[model samples]
Target: MHVVMTSAGIGRIEDGAVAVLDAPYPDPNTVIETTGSLDALGGAKVVRRIPLDGDELDLRAPLGRPRALWGVGLNYHSKAERTGRPAPDEPVLYLAGSSSVSAPGAAVRLPAEETVQMDYEAEIAVVIGRTLDRAAESEAWSAVAAITAANDMTARDVMKRTGTPALAKSFPGFTPLGASLLARDAIADPDAIGVRSWVGDERRQDSSSADMIFAIPELLARISRYAALRPGDVVLTGTPAGTGQDRDDFLRPGDTVRIEVDGVLPLTTHVRA
Candidate 1:
């Protein structure tokens, strides 16, 4: 079953009545309201079935709101090699602002205060289904409910010059995520999915989860050791080797970025000053 948390409400796709699972923290509330039973609201009958029109409603983050936006850097072997960085023994993590979250089709702002080396990185974002701490690799799968495509837009100049990635990465409207959140069951193998990015009609990043230095399960296990993973928190799996910055090409105003991953919907947004 595919699920989405929109500005409208929490909805489960299928012939079912949409259950109101409280705004903002709907994932945990939905689980609690259903008493651990996904079908607790009665059945597919009770869910309010509404027609999905892409233009009618705005797609918020898969979760109405997330606690933190955690991202992995250089997890892809090819990406690490391109930047002359070693493949990390563990996930190289960073935090993007929760305020940076924007939906697909929205305009991503280029930070005028910063240098013009803005780049696009296509990644698979993991949406946590439940709160967990020190979770084992085998148990990590249970903690994730859905997956979506995310563009980890960055300002390479700010990152390299200031030596502070946070400044470059956390700009407002930097992360543009897609709408559809594919359920775990829909994705048979998370580590085998394909991810690709395109600038206009040109295909840029083409890679598979198989190339990840540290796979999703290991990343979840490693991250959970220190901080508690809460429901609705997003873990942005690293991007592949073909980022514009790596090629010394940067995004210009009016360019469109499209990211696609197998099992999830494609996300497209435009760049603007």
Candidate 2:
């Protein structure tokens, strides 16, 4: 089942329509709530059916108030090449706070100063279903509940000036999460999907997650060693090389950014001043 969090509340996509559940999940804040048993709402009937072409509901990230949002930097070979940095001995991790979360249709508010030089990084995000501590690499994928598309919008100038990406990365609405959360069973191979980003018609990133320097299992395993992985935690699997910074370009007000992974729904964000 594809789960979504909308202005109307938690919903399930069926028969090409979004059926609003009778009762929103008791904890409507995290994807973990849907893990293992989305059927918890089995007795609940659909209160309404919103057609896909109907006026779009205000969509929110499938997970509400995630306990932790972890971002991997330069995990993609292409990204490492573009940034002129060698691959790290270990994943370069950053904490993306819940405050940066935004729904698919939300506006990405740019700083008033045009010099912020915002850029977009399209990534495949994994949502954890169970708590994991020092999980074995072979067992990491088992802990994942779902996969979704995410756009890791960055403030390039701010990052360069501050010499820290996390500070610039945590701006409100910097993260535009997918509209649909596809359960793990739905994905044939989580590591082989295509991840791409576009600004209007300009394609900026086009690469597969298979090229990640550290695949999902290894990434999760390594991360688990550092901290406990709880349900509802999100792991952004890093972006490919085609960030705007690579082309000496950047996002501006009025631009629209679209990010997509092969198996999950796409996420679109409007850049606004």
Candidate 3:
């Protein structure tokens, strides 16, 4: 199922129509009402409907406000290599504030005098559907509800000054989320999802989850061992090699960054100062 947040409500892009869900947008009840089972959305009544391609709608972040956004660092071999560092022995994790979440078509306003070296990381984000505490690899997938694309935008200046991934990446509108979300079951191969990113007219990253050193199952299982993963929580599975930091390039006003994750929605963000 392809889920989207429309002005009317949470809706599904299926059955040749954009069927508005009876569940309200930003309400966790839709999933929570069913014990965090995203499959329960299949049973949600359609309050109303619109043409799938109609212009009478506006798209918002599919999840509205996720409970948390867990960012995984150096999870991709190519990404680590880009920094001339060896792949880490463990998942480098950071807890980004959910306040940074932005709608798919939103604009990213660069912080004034805080940082100008903005960068983008194209990543595939996993949306949790259940409460998982110390889950095993075999149990991780079952805890997942959907997959979405994320532009893990970073303010490199802040990171360099603070040396904290979470703080550096949690600026408002820093985490560009989605225009659509794909139900987990719709994906045949989670491990091989293709990920790509573009900075303005230039293509910056071109890699897939296949290049990730620690896959989703392992990442989720490992994280669950320490922190409880709950419904509406999202895990950003690091980006590919090519980034502005590696190329000595950074985002500037008027630049547009686009990220696409195969099997889910793609996102585009316009940069502003």
**The best candidate in terms of TM-score:** 3
TM-score of 2: 0.92
Worst lDDT 10-window in candidate 3: 24-33
* lDDT agreement with native, every candidate: 0.76, 0.82, 0.84
TM-score of predicted model 3? 0.93
TM-score of each: 0.86, 0.92, 0.93
lDDT of 3 by residue, 16-124 (tens): 6778888643533255425665566688899888886678878777766677789988888887877889898889999998999999889889886788788898999
Runs of candidate 3 with Cα error greater than 4 angstroms are 15-17, 24-34
Candidate 2 on 1-273: residue-level lDDT in tens? Answer: 677777787887777788888774743334364544344544568898888667866567676567789998889988888788998899988887788988887887888663558989999988888777999999999888778889988888888888787777888998888877877777788678799999999888999978999999899999999998887788999999888888888888999999988866678999988
Clashes of each: 7, 2, 0
Write down the RMSD of all candidates, one decimal each. Answer: 3.5, 2.0, 1.9
CA lDDT of 71 in candidate 1?
89
What tens-digit string does per-residue lDDT give for candidate 1 at 72-105?
Answer: 8889999989989888777778777878877767
Ranking by TM-score: 3, 2, 1
Higher-ranked by TM-score: 2 or 3: 3
Put the candidates in lDDT order, highest first. 3, 2, 1
Maximum-lDDT candidate: 3
